[model samples]
Target chain A: MAVSSQVLSYYSFEQVDITRFRIRPEINRQKVEAEFSRAVYPYITWTDGTELYAGDYAVLIIRSDNPKLCRSGLKVTIGAGLLGAEFEKALSGKKVGDSFSVLWKGETVFVTVESVKNRHKPELSDDMIAALNIPDVKTVAAYQTHLEKKELDEFFFEHSRDAVGYVLKQVQANSSILVTEADWNQTVEWSVNRLAALAAMDGMELRTMTPEDFRGRIPVKSYDELVVLMQREAWESVRMSLLGEYLAKQNGDTINADGYETFLTEAAAPWGRTAEEYRKAYPEAYYLQNEYCDYFRRAVTAYVRKNYFKEEKNEH
Target chain B: MSIKFAEASTFDNLVREDDFVIVDFFSTSCGPCKILSTFLEDLEAELPFLSIVKVNTMEAPELAERFEIHAVPTLFFYQGGELKERHLGVLDEDELRERIERYLY
Candidate 1:
């Protein structure tokens, strides 16, 4: 598929932080919190190795103006990832002033319960629900049961797609320009260090600490073994990047799904495994490869549309 | 009550004393430096065996320049005016503790 012009309009990863500030401060706390909730929260650590916050950098919720919302309890919605689910569970039944720690994005973060606020919980009115569908639901429980099975799934799927779209848009905007080896190295090193910190939080040491001690703390077999696994992961990512660059040069257009299966089959040949076998061994890898291919294709289309197609349009 | 600040002017006097000296060079704006500051403050409270000195880059630009500091935060471990090891950027509290333990003990 050709890259959408909308994808090209996205800002780079470095620009993401700057964009957060562009929102007006006058906006309601709920809206601000909603926006902040979408941000990738970093693991907060004190200088003394104490973790202070486990959830997202920020969180948002809606409730009735009645104080009963505080006493009745709260529900928090997090992303689908492991950390997200964990945060939701941790926040459940938590009252104000309660402090706890949980693994967030692989690192342990400490969280304190902030003040609970009362706000309007937006729901489809009963009349509106009836107007849309003739299903005569009696109680809130029946309506909730109906919504849970289908609507929740649709809502999450839509949000997930939007999040991925945002990242892809960023990648497209950052395309065409070559990243310097220094810049790449810096980013990679920072990622590694962050990973190391996460491992440390899990009580697994990257160096010096014994394997048994590490295993007692983390779910991994050994620190050395984990290091090897991490290295392999990094290598695959780098290899995919090289493949993306190669495809970008050859096609002149982005390599979309039409080229994906062939590319995977050929790429897997060097590893003594068929594409199908590789997919079986690492299903996530296949998904990542497809995504990267799609990104590359979008970048090519974006480059073409911005330069060649625009020029053609101008001529007309 | 004597509130003796860790000033560069007192470096020579501190060298004559019988203690391991740690000079922390840090800027106010650096995240790592800010973290290290709190760490050093905590270390000072807990470890009475050694002297932990802090030098703000804003106030002690001359000392920072003398040390060839190109970064916002740098830690110099010293014993009797001799430099032992230097660390740059953010460090974990455990790591810092171990470093101190190694040097002091």
Candidate 2:
């Protein structure tokens, strides 16, 4: 449910009178140490009297005075702008064992700060470095540098994906895409294979069952209607292919004949086919249409990453 | 509850002997097959006329191949020793009862 702006503006609300608060929030160093010691990845370090600041991961126990809202444990990153403003206000100054009550949707919501995680980079000892065993990363300092590089690579990849997706959406919105007969057949085959795999997992067989056979067995009656649905589903993938070709042409990322042959061989490997057999199975026009589309997307995305993306400082 | 067991050699004989028979093709390591086996055993009591034949695909590789059995727990229905219906996968108790009723009459 969307909370109104008026409710968000008012941080203070009617306080709840609890007959019995099940667990009182209390800051215990021993408990904190134990929790920290158990944590591995994104290692937690215990600190005294640390108020949960913005970007801090805090574990909270939330209970509603109204039985309808119920009680649940919530793991939240404080100041990530995810939690409601009022919820953040109630939690900002609170540390481990502190409790506060907030009004939400005309119901009194009681919140207890279970634990505030104050994280610090673990000591990069030889043991820690050895555990990772990443190539060319021997020292703790080297591992940190390697992580920074990997993070940069990830940032570029994410940005390129978003940019291509945005560009594709706009391009697709403007044009009419025609789903070929071969494309429709491929989609139906994929759908049938997926269904067969799921059935096999349940110790059931779907031996040699085509999409038509599957549709007949299910609630869906009309084969034509199923075809239409499959066509509608295939549009996005078809558009991706079209956009890939368009992007490749626009950016001059063209594949040579030799490169195409090599790609065909690699692509056919999963299907346990030689490139010659694969080419014969799929007509030249059909093969090139899909193959070039994939090649373009990969090429254009790489180009966008290399030329257009910059990494920013990320919150842990 | 009694479930008639079949090997590659006895498979034809088992189906031919019964007026209605269901051959359950399954593997030992298959978890869903185990559940379906228990369900079939319970079902045998409810439908005494329905002769259920259990065939281990591992033991009867030739039978599995002859039937083109790609996945485990495949059920092939036979009436008067002729293949009538084929179903692959775990059926819930209701579905199993309904399928059995469809062939029984």
Q: Candidate 1: what lDDT?
A: 0.47
TM-score of chain A of each: 0.24, 0.34
- Model 1 C-alpha lDDT per residue in residues A1-316, reported as the tens digit of each score: 6431112132333333222212111213443343222121111121311212332222223223333322122222222122257765776555556667765545565666544322222343444334434376544445555544344334334434443445445554454434345434533444346456544544555666566666555455665665565565554344335446455555574533565565545444322234674344334434444466555545534442223211233343
Model 1, span B1-105: residue lDDT tens: 011245668756664454467777765556677777666654443332347667766566566667766565788887657788898777767778677555543
lDDT of 1 at B30: 62
- Cα deviation of A237, candidate 2, in Å: 5.6
Best by lDDT: 2
Clashing pairs in 2: A25-A97, A26-A97, A204-B89
Error of 1 at A98 (Å): 44
RMSD per candidate (Å) reads 23.4, 23.9
CA lDDT of A150 in candidate 1?
Answer: 46
Mind giving the per-residue lDDT tens digits that candidate 2 earns over A1-316?
A: 7431111111110121211211212234443343233223323343433578754656677787677655444555555334556776678877788888887557778888887765343644656665666788776667656655565565555445556555445445555555556665665655545444444433556664446555645444444554565556555655555555555665687643445566555444333334675454444544555665677556545545444532233411
Per DockQ, the best of the predicted structures is: 1
Candidate 1 segments whose C-alpha is farther than 4 A from its true place: A1-316, B1-5
